[model samples]
Target: MAALLAAALAVTGCTAAEPGAAPRAEDARPTVISVTDGDVDLAILGEVYARVLTSGGYDVQLEIHSAQDPVSSADRLLAGEADFIVGCTGELLADFNPAGAEEIIDQWPELEEEGVGGFVVYDELIASLPSRLSATDPSSATSCDDAAEEQGLTQQVVPIFGATLFDREQREALTGITRLITTADLEDMEEAAEETGSVVEAVDEWVLDNEARSGGAFEDDREDVSYLYTP
Candidate 1:
């Protein structure tokens, strides 16, 4: 996995900025970023982030890794080539800290108990890897039922960091974006994306609605998510 990540990053090691088509105000110096992750679904989520932040007047450049695992994607962030990377809890746990991977098991106690959005357990995922490789509905196609008992383990998705140093303002931007998504909302958005014939548009609309919400699920009272990654 590490080698694959390295190879992928090496092949695509360059900043990809959004064109100046809808450029921000003249005084605006948007923070250019390359958002990356392994899954296409997560890539769409990155687009959601880009759409929301851009509308909020933040200069953001979005990039999709077009890969299947986030190992290299996170590596992109740590290397300063990308500003943001989002991955599932399981993916973050394994590759968030290349120097101290054991921290994945130590932190994120919720992974040991249950995953957010009813994500199946890791062991079960391993058990069904062969079939999962070809499954259409990736999330629900897991063979994590009675057949894979005693091997179930949940892996929730979350943003992680520690290896990178950020200035005060960058730090604020990084930590300020709270978890605005829920399981049902995610499923609905996924379906809507398919129905509307445009995943990017669906995600953009959802981000706008979430931003418009006042003190809703993703609001001012949101909490820090670093603990989900660090000890």
Candidate 2:
């Protein structure tokens, strides 16, 4: 499972046609931007933003680094080494407050105003076990498997991401695990268990089946099943 997760992370990590290709001398003043490292989707998005800015008559320079150590990048922006930092709202919030940096523009209004959500998944069997399993005594033969059969339950998939959950620790831990099949909310758990095998379908299906009542759980993003799915 760990190997599978590492593979997934590798597949998702950023790649570029050319690293740090600067514009010609005659181009407009460069607009440098930095993004969190290891986040492939955000890295690609940052590159796209840089290209767009360059085409719009602004020379662009983009850098990718780890959010775990973002202070130096933020310092670059403040000291004029870079023009902007592309990162999560939390980073912006922290930097803006401490460094007195003002936002020239916000590309993602949704993140600025509404915030993001996370995805979560859990083992379906956890809920199906006999009530006796909850007993304080460990001498009982009860187990997660026993609960799975007693409830005639089927294994289900859950999805989670960073921005949604209130707990950052839990979210980070989930990122390292190959299989996470539970949700923080019980209602979401029930809805996910009902979906069973079709967890990878459209977001609208999840919304219709779970979100309205479950108060918005994680949306499924599993494209390859060999990692977590077991038949």
Candidate 3:
């Protein structure tokens, strides 16, 4: 693991594409997914997805939201300004209107108003402190009145996003990729990213360890591409 970590750090860390490094696109434009917001776990998830996308031979560009709000990010996605978004905290919205959204299970009352309600997008469980979350977890309850009744939350849940990728192929490729990620596993990668000061390095190590479970989501056919992210 240490050797893998070191090697990953070397390859991806402290390097940028040399001047005019690209061979330039001669065919159809490479698909662009504008993943947003720089919260630690959100950024980490984006980086993980970016890694997977590049592995499948799609060109990806990651950008921070200048506005950094879910409404704006989602608007961007619909407008085609952004392709993907990893939303966290203030950036996400829990809608109170229309009586629809994902439900966030095991959620705290105080936090009920703060999270996006309706559907949980990832498989990571949001921790007692909300340091962890996954795609499969519900977004959170929509109504505070409803929450006080249904909620058994000692902790708050974070909303994880489903595929939402613009490219049909990338979306299809990542299906069933969610695996159970314990709090310990999340912290391990997060701590490693912080220690190395490299989200890419830590994610690379994680992908190496978990790829089989992900159905080769991290396997790279395009050697020329690499994506960088910060949390």
**Which structure among the candidates has the greatest lDDT?**
3
Q: After TM-score superposition, what is the CA distance of residue 33 in candidate 3 from its true location, in Å?
A: 3.0
Q: List the lowest-lDDT window of 10 residues for candidate 1.
A: 222-231
Question: Candidate 3, residues 1-231: lDDT per residue as tens digits?
Answer: 322222222222212122354432322343344454433554566566566556555566655444335445445544545444544322233322111122344343434476533223122222221221122333221212232243332222232332222223332234333223334555677788899997677877887888666654566433434443333
Per-model lDDT: 0.39, 0.31, 0.42
Query: TM-scores of the models, in the given order?
Result: 0.49, 0.29, 0.51
Task: Name the better of 2 and 3 by lDDT.
Answer: 3
Candidate 3, residue 28: how far the Cα is off, in Å: 4.2
Alpha-carbon runs more than 4 Å astray in model 3: 1-28, 66-71, 88-173, 180-183, 221-231
- Encode model 1's per-residue lDDT on 39-105: one tens digit a residue: 3356555565454344333445555544543347556655545545555534443443332334334
Position 174, candidate 2: lDDT: 28
lDDT of 2 by residue, 45-109 (tens): 34433432332233345666664663554465545555433333222233334222122123234
Model 2, stretches more than 4 Å misplaced? 1-29, 66-70, 98-231
Residue 31, model 2: Cα distance from true site in angstroms: 2.4
- The residue-level lDDT of candidate 2 at 204 comes to 32
